[model samples]
Target: MSNRLLTYNPETEGAEGGLLIMGAPTRAAQPQPSTELEELELGSAFLEATSTSELASVVNRILRHGALLAGKPIASQVVQHLGARLNRAGQSVRTLLAPPAGRSDTAPSEAMERITGAELEGLSDEDKEFETARAFVRFAMEAGRLAARAPSTQPPAAVATAAARVAARRHAPGLDFVQLVPGFRARRAIRRQSFA
Candidate 1:
């Protein structure tokens, strides 16, 4: 009978006695879907929306999807806060589309004129709708960014204001249109009756 010798090769064996095979190819990780593509698709959907309700639906879907992706359900209060801000923006767009009461021939209100200058009256219906949709998308993006953080870290109004500021910048850079769109505190008091 012949005796066989067993060898423990340090290079092929782990310190804990587990075999460590070298040169073995590991499985590749699956690729994640691109957020930029998703945002582009959402933006297109927003632009294609024919009505305010349709646009709201798209916004809701986006916010919910964002919450899900973040692994945290959005609070109802947060949703309401966002809805209120969106309503303000929608009202602003409606106002822009139709001239103020008893002032059909004239431009929009003095406040609107002050905020947007003469450009307010020059925008066609299509242009107004496009700008409104763009503002909504920008607001939604900013809201999603804020919502990703711990809910208790900031108040809903603060979050809404921050998002609205970003949206306003996207809507009309270097303009004070945020007061007309989201109606921040300074202007909100002045337009409280109109909003109601």
Candidate 2:
């Protein structure tokens, strides 16, 4: 009953009639630019996506433009859209989990510095969260700080301390799902012997 584009071909299907409403040509006919310079000219339209329709428009535009050049696919527009959404989500998570009135982005790095500078003995439950992020960031920021310090500082004790901090973090508010599985537990034995 509805009107739509139809196709008839004798070569492919022995003279069968088919409804061709939304085929590749239909998509490819959307007036996409042929060159990178033309694409660059549409910058504001690409980056100004706030809704799904707007995002899809940008993606479709890129795909169309790419199809003209070497028939390559352009999937990066979707990736860029997803990346923007994820950055906002990460910032929100950082803000909500951060200590009261503390910043979102700087909190993780700051927590790392604090634990590294402090004596590990008398920290409370909240301090344990800071210390956990600190230990993680320290191990990440400095290649072998834990390995170097653990021996002089005592291995089993440091590992146990790190393990305890990880556990405490597992119990903290707004951080129930993330568990710190020290990927370098193998290094602990070396630390134990060297420190002992």
Candidate 3:
């Protein structure tokens, strides 16, 4: 018997200097990609347009990419990604995952437990966090390749507000009502002459 799971059992007679029996190992099937996830591919335009936040959004989009990818789940995926990022930056996972004071129903209390699962129990908070962060970085980097279109180049709220204010000021002095009404000025002159 070669496999660790198998040991020599006396059920069958073993011949001296004969071939030994070994256990046949079974491999799990690999995951296949789906059409929806394939649709999210980042094109050249998207790669050039995305900022850090847009990259992060693309990562979220992956969770809903398709039936195959959706099985991975978003809450767990984000936790793992963010945790790892914090760890690599030499920050504590506690800072991100730990619940705030006097809060009974926080993200850590509710979401973390679901995402971590039983198998990951042995992992330290920092290790889990690191893994999570690494996942995020990987997703973000790959997201550019999967993006369908370039991000919008719209101006920020502040800039838009400023522009609006300038436009408002441009017309602020007021309208000329006398010139606006075609016959008002002539009517006023006739009234003035009659009164005099």
lDDT computed for candidate 1: 0.51
lDDT of 1 by residue, 1-196 (tens): 3221234445434555543322122123222332766666776676666677886777787777556554566667667776666655645544554655677544543334443323545666565444544445555654544454333445555545554454344333323353444336745653453344
The order of the candidates by lDDT, greatest first, is 1, 2, 3
Better-scoring candidate (TM-score), 1 or 3: 1
In candidate 1, how many Å is residue 10 off? 57
Candidate 2 structure quality by residue, lDDT tens digits, 105-190: 45554443343444444655455444543332222211111111222233333333332233223222222223233347645754
For 1-196, candidate 3 gives per-residue lDDT tens digits of 5652253333211443221111111122333444432433432212332344544444444334421332332234333433233222212213334446866644443233333222335567545544433332233332221111111122222122222222122221111110122257755653554345
lDDT of 2 at 142: 19
Task: Estimate TM-scores for all models.
Answer: 0.46, 0.22, 0.24
For each candidate, how many residue pairs have backbone atoms clashing (under 3 Å)? 0, 1, 14
Q: Relative to the unseen true structure, what is the Cα RMSD of model 1?
A: 19.6
Candidate 3 minimal-lDDT segment of 10 residues:
171-180
Model 2: which ten-residue window has the lowest total lDDT?
A: 19-28
Candidate 1 segments whose C-alpha is farther than 4 A from its true place: 1-34, 68-71, 90-135, 166-196
